[model samples]
Target: MTLTFASPDQPAIALHVIDQDARDGWLEAQPPQVQAWVAANGFTGALGQVLLIPGADGAPDRALAGYGTTDRRARVRFPLAAAAEALPEGTYAIASGLPADRAEIEALGWLLTGYAFDRYATQSAAKARLVAPDGVNAARVEIMANAEALIRDLVNTPAADMGPDQLQAAAEALAGEFGAQFEVTRGDALLERNFPMIHAVGRAAEQAPRLIEMTWGTSGPKLTLVGKGVCFDTGGLDLKPAAAMGLMKKDMGGAANVLGLARMIMALDLPLQLRVLIPAVENAVAGNAFRPGDILTSRKGLTVEINNTDAEGRLVLADALALADEGAPDLVISMATLTGAARVAVGADLAPFYTDDDAAAQALSQAAFQAADPVWRMPFHTPYETLIEPGIADLDNAPAGGFAGSITAALFLRRFVENSRYMHFDIYSWQKAKEPGRSKGGLGQGPRALLTALPGMLDL
Candidate 1:
């Protein structure tokens, strides 16, 4: 909740970023005292290396940061994070031989280093601040940083506090803030509303499952966002190992990320009509829990066989996608942490996205690199359609053989979405270790790339 953006044109301490090839020339132009300090410390301009120079009054002068050579292979991702995190709590300016987007990159890292999840703890975060770098829009950078922070906050909260009801409250509050319309279909109402698959997957838990819907923007092309809001996945009738259940709280991370993206779109006032749909549920075990071998009817009127109750996220998402497809929106994107195969295929950092639209796929590929967000476009392989088909039902919720699990799961969701230009992101959402700008907790994976690519795609 800190005001991270500042507008001071000049600052006392500055970070001069240099590459190894340009280090000697930059240092020779410096004052003799600074040259002596640099020699004393053996300051070779390696990536992430930091050097502190001394002033004439024996006080601290401007700092030095090393960005590697101009070669793409030598460059590091989020390189400014090290300098930003190491700096003390004061405003600083940026001086570097970076590309045209240098100002935006440095400002983003400055805000990222200040993030700390101290809700239940007594410790305060490091209060590092920076002046708005030249040529960068401070307001735009803050909008993106705040949205990413919101995603981490919602995903990091324990399931005991973040359940189906809390998820609905978050969406309602977001809609109210922007004057958007909001409604939730709860409990038995889901059955009456023709969302039978959603109701069956969540009826076991004490917290009645529901669908969270929000509508905004009165004009422009329509974009419908559907997120799998499985608040806590207990694996239902088929249980999981204790270690596997440890991070089930993060199953709702897709919902958190979609909400974050929605926040960014509204904050920027993009020229597009946006609607968010989340099927919030808790797949817990009870006496009346839906069992395996149960063939349930979906909102799309297709019957799905429950091969394993553990595969409940897709069931809830199927109904939501059906409702979104009914409107034939310009774009439909569904995000979920639904498969272990995705993590196995691309690891935790790189998420896999499936899309049948070639132009959107190309745009997302380009945006991922420019935005510094890692996402790979996996094929919506038509050949894998046989894997999702069971003998008895129109589709199988949990297909066996474990071959191409992620592809088969995507194919299963495609059955519910018939007409829209669809994209599905199978994300991990939780970071097991700390990276340059990301911490060892919940992280937003694919939203930044979409934010960068959407305006151009919609011709806004």
Candidate 2:
């Protein structure tokens, strides 16, 4: 399903806002046509409810979409989505009564209502065109929609068609499209490059695990993005049960989201030296699989004890983060489908990000609010550092206590990062169910927010 922006000569649809307290003169200021439409349809402004008034020829004339109150920002997005569902498959323009900046979000809403993941089945055609409002930034809206579509497509694809090698191809494709330099270090080369933790976690898979690196831009402050690219996590030696492993195909959602962000950055042509580091690996079970209670060396020269092989995202990320740290970029941010604890804490809609730098955290939070991407700030409590201490080694991959799992995971990744200002996002990449602009699949967590924030960060 696709949402087209149209400028047809077809009759326009007036969006009549319904108000419940009509007797108290709540809707006295409304136009006669709107008042008549409300009276004719018997519409009260209850949330999520909509009414269609018929024209003189007995065809649908205009729509009355109910809202809670005039002063509230309590508009229902799904009802707007239901407009896409209920309206006759054709183009429609909002005649009046919507805030100026909301057009972009409304366009996103229109596109989202038509999104369907039909990889294994046939898809039905979509028929809804939300006409762009005058003076609205249609190009920006289209860019965001395409970026989101890219992320959703990658995340929804099954592991059978998207593995480590395929992930590399995707990254390389992104680099090629943007005229960026791309490189990959695989198999024995990982060991040669001192990426021992990466080699240890991925040695069992038929596909040799590697790091995908791409660099774009030539000037301004350096920005590095690191994403954990575990394609299909079988939990390695400490394997997950069947139920727990069901959604493991989305393990590389971090990689998908970063690629989406890259698409936006290059599309907008942000002035910054952009670097992307993705440690692509498949944590599959095999004879040579790394097991629990094993000590592993890291590229950063930190000795790690594998308390559980399922915590392999951090391992692969450690090597990648070490490489990013080596460059000492001005800013480094890493995102991952790293832990279930994050979902337990913030649910799927709002991803939680951890950062030691207050200014960067504020900037990210501000960006999230401005873009409507919405990420919560998780504390980077330095006291939690003790939770990741290893008795036998320099650090333990999995902490003993289940409490503060997400915080501990952030602490674990922080061990490999130094010199650069860093932030970590422990994201539950998949959305459980569909919402206004979010389709029910692997969701793009931070790209939208970061894309909005990067241009100014690079002084573009």
Candidate 3:
């Protein structure tokens, strides 16, 4: 559902943020009746708890939202978001208790909670809205929130509704909105473009395999982003278990995230030329499905032995990353739902990132902390590099030991990138449970951290 923001980003109501320890000082200064009512209600100012106070006339006067307790700390991931969701459906103005610099992320979090994948359902109620706070880039916050919502919507959609063609169309629509140049190489055209691995994996699906590309900005440092866009991974010829297949629609989360990041860059007009590449495909089973024993030559001409068909995300990404590396962009980062090993290590909330550049890695680490997007660095250890090099091919798509799956996958993609500073993010884009700001499905990992790191990375 589309959200509404107050024109001029003005406050329609007051939203007070407080912790139990500090609630007394603020409550003591309040009028006697409001204090009496709050005490009577037994509100302790727990995190995510919101209480609405009444005015003298019994009308809703203001909202009191709890920040976490001082002792335990908090995720603070959109700390103000719960307040926005619990407050009445209208614009809200947050009261002090947080830093002014955090206004954008906090406000953006509020905007995100209002998101619902309403494609199949009718509206039940109006969503609570927030007024842009002072010093907050209200327009930019809205743009980023909308872009995030777009990612969730795309990822949450089922394979029937969100195939390779639909993903290409979505990218085309985004390019049209930002005046970026859009192009796609579909079906056998992938072969013409020397993307044989991508073509091999996706050839069995009904929708033709394709690479979606968009370019924007002409000057400044080149920022090229690549994402794995497996629209639905049925594990190809190897197939997947029923439970594994259930969430397969979200396999293209990396694609949705990069597109969301592209949206943010274009909307904020970051001073860097940007190019986004998504190898959109559906790994379906058919007589022509690429076999597990099959050896395929990648765009970079490196032969990969298909140790398992389930490990197909890296195949398409290898071709796209090869193409991206050719541009010699200042930085080339790729994100993909590439391995279960990553999820097993970090769970769904934290995404694991791999980078050979120490300067970039340090910047991203600091940015991740500042932005509250969790990213842990996995080593691109040259020692384990041989794990991907099975005797039959230059690399093994699924190494036999089953050890260091994520690390090995990152090492595999590392070969495709020749010149640019490279970073690879293995993300579990699906949120199995609802959090304060994040909903229950389809999330963007690394993009926010990347956004936070870009200014320093690009020397902007």
TM-scores of the candidates are: 0.96, 0.91, 0.96
Better of 1 and 3 by lDDT: 3
How far residue 45's Cα lies from its native spot in candidate 1, in Å, is: 2.9
State in Å the error of residue 313, model 3: 0.8
Give candidate 3 regions above 4 Å deviation.
8-11, 71-73, 123-126
lDDT of 1 by residue, 1-460 (tens): 6437655764557768777788999989988878888889987777667776767776667788766566731344577776666666666677665556666866776687777777888544546577777788888888888888888888988889899999999889889988889999999999999999889989998899999999999899999999999999989999988898999999999999999999999999998999999999999999989999999989999999999999998999999999999999999999999999999999888879999899998998888887777799999999888888897999998888888888889999999999899999999999888756677788898998999989766777
Worst 10 residues of 2 by lDDT: 17-26
- Which window of ten consecutive residues has the lowest lDDT sum in model 3? 2-11
lDDT of 2 by residue, 124-203 (tens): 43365677776667667676777777778888889888888889998898899889999999998999988888888888
Which regions of candidate 1 are displaced past 4 Å? 9-11, 68-76
Better of 2 and 3 by lDDT: 3
lDDT of 3 by residue, 198-271 (tens): 89989999999999999999988999999889999999888898998999999999999999999989989999
